[model samples]
Target: MEKPWTKSVTLALEGPGKYVTISNTTEASWAMIEDWPLDDAPALNRALDICAAAVEGKRPAEDARKAFIEAAVEADIEIRE
Candidate 1:
């Protein structure tokens, strides 16, 4: 099983005030695969790979978090601090 991150990544979706918080590798993986608005992107693919590695204990959760943020930016999604 995957462990939760030190801090959650909050992002705003398409609509105003709508938000989703991804707190772990699993949630990040799901969001990228299912909830992401873009069909395909380099950053998205990198995030998916990083998330998978993190879940398998091959990479740090922080790496996944950074990759997720990059993917969100590539998709033009708004990330909240």
Candidate 2:
């Protein structure tokens, strides 16, 4: 029951040149669990939980999106507008 966010979040995955666009809870979760560079962090854990909740239909996808952004910031990842 994964849900898509109203807007997508773009992150610079391999520095400023490369990027990944996450548009839904599932993508966010995958990015956090599989592609994230940091081993662990408070914001990363929070984002994982929120993404799970969003996929389970217990929370809005936008919540997961916000959490993902926070996690990205915590990991020193660049967020593109």
Model 2 pairs whose backbones collide = none
TM-score of model 1 vs. true structure = 0.91
lDDT of 2: 0.87
lDDT digits (tens) for residues 1-81 of candidate 2: 444689999999766769989888888888888889997899999999998887787888888899999999999999989
Task: Count steric clashes of candidate 2.
Answer: 0
Give per-model TM-scores. 0.91, 0.91
lDDT, residue 23, model 1: 91
- Error of model 2, residue 54, in angstroms: 0.8
Error of 2 at 69 (Å): 0.4
